[model samples]
Target: MTSSSPLHILVIEDNPDLAANVCDFLEAKGHAVDVAGDGLTGLHLAVTQNYDAIVLDIVLPGMDGLTLCRKFREEAMRTTPVLMLTARDALDDRVAGLECGADDYVLKPFALRELEARLKALVRRASSAVTPSVLRVGDLEYDPALIRVRRGTRTITLPPIPLKLLETLMRAAPRVVRREELERAVWGDAPPDSDALRAHLHVVRAAIDGAGEPPLIHTLRGVGYRMMAPDAL
Candidate 1:
């Protein structure tokens, strides 16, 4: 991502004037902004859609900001950077907001420029978390930011699960990745039973292997799987 790249932002504020001002200012900065007037609407959008950053208000009708933020983090498993809007004197609310998972908070009477700067900082942090510097093994390469795979010069697109599987494999390149380890990396604590890991690995292997170059993924008989150049074996 570049400094000029437009970010998709979700602004959940009840005040019309504040919402308009924020949306307009962020829009002027070349960001695509989505506005929700209530916490319910905001929570729905935040959970269902993908946004680069979120500007959330502390109080809203239907649900409070803290509850919404908590649900967004816990239920959705999302780490989208959140910039909270709060009154300066609401010290308790600010503390509670951070506890509920707001990345940073901006005072109600904050300077618009300062708010934008903090948001950009949060975006930089979040981007770094999701997009590794680079992952390479042999002649294969993957850019997590772009979510694209390449061998030599040919680029390929993959579905979300296979893409994640490929990332796990490439990150552990030339080493055997245990089945349980890959499952936990891809599916977390709630992995599917009954050889689901094997099924997904099959798809991932077919996508990254077979056609381009030699097969890089290999089964290790009774143990697990490893990725390596053909000659490495």
Candidate 2:
């Protein structure tokens, strides 16, 4: 995407020719683009640094784009818009990518200008959505509007996805939200294939139930998770 001030972007694609073409076009448009030949390097760069947007490829060594994108949301807590690249025109791959947290995608052999347009739309959507001011369950609090969480006096910093998950749980405090329902809220129509939810929940719980705090996020065995003060449970 072209901006008045240049935007920094990451492109994680293994194809040398394709990567070079994408980078060259974006650089010509005044955006700084960082290339990662594989998923591992891409994940590292994305986790450690901040980028305005990411252009990710679905297939790569070390890790796939689907997992990398999911980790970006679940672990890094990054809300940076992602534009996924794929060679397949199959609907399943696109859905899988979106479910894994990609903001958008373009099939391979596409126009550079079209990719750029989708990337611009992704950035705009990330910036424009309005979220509620506050959601609380007892001492636990999550502010989607500001993108912050708090329990008692402790402030919990979570990546965007976990934070959203926390908000969903807290808003339904003391009630066991069904697995299907929570998944829909977290990943929209497409959820992860593996048991990825629990991993993200672990990070959320670590931050939310640290030290003497009674765990408010409770797994309801076969059901789902519920948020409530221990006394309330």
Candidate 3:
């Protein structure tokens, strides 16, 4: 297999030896790895840095991994995929972890091979689905690759989550994108709540439509949302 792009991985495990071992193994596989002994520090790193994936332990100090994951989603609005690690093998724990925003889970005592495979699958899926380059909705444009946005001659700068939300909408321009779809696109499979989508939409509207050229992003009542040129109507 062709080596994929180096993925930045954050490991939040309290066990010093295990954490170091996992990090070392991932780094040896060409991934850039960072280790945090506590959930709070891991959350901070995850929010501030653009990590390809996170390996989080359920039992942690300062903050538990589940709470950290939820907090990260709520506060930073980050959509980075997470693989939750847990010593508990109960089905309820697994379900709860998934509900909390974990894309995948690996029970403790997992083989290194299993961990590597899960990480690879997560990263590959993330990399293949969307090109984080640019998004276009008629004359309006946002180039994530360049970290810039433009409507005609004017350029705009947006904070990360709002930009991500706008990009998701722009990618589905002219089509009514369902609320659930938007949540999965911008926040991953495990989303906060239904209201979160509305809040982000408001921010997107203010930034993209408030200027008054012509609103491109539109809500389709109960259906979802769409972005299209005003002339297209």
How do the residues 133-168 of candidate 2 rate in per-residue lDDT, one tens digit apiece?
688887887777777777888877664456667878
lDDT accuracy of residue 224 in candidate 1? 84
* Clashing residue pairs in candidate 3 (N, C-alpha, C atoms within 3 angstroms): none
User: TM-score of every model?
Assistant: 0.55, 0.57, 0.55
lDDT of 1 by residue, 1-233 (tens): 55567889999999999999989999999889999999999999998999988999998988989999989887887878888888744445555666577766666787787777767766764554465568887778899876568888778645444566788888888789998888777555645434445545655665677585788888998798888977777
* Each prediction's whole-model lDDT (CA): 0.77, 0.78, 0.76
| Tens digit per residue, CA lDDT, model 3, 45-114 | 9998988889999999999998998887767878787888888866667656655656667777877767
Better of 1 and 3 by lDDT: 1
Candidate 3 C-alpha error for residue 131, in Å: 13
Q: How many residue pairs collide in each prediction?
A: 0, 1, 0
Scored by lDDT, model 1 comes in at 0.77
* The 10-residue segment with the lowest total lDDT in model 2: 190-199
Q: Which portions of model 3 miss their true places by more than 4 Å?
A: 1-3, 130-233
Model 1: how large is the Cα RMSD against the reference? 14.1
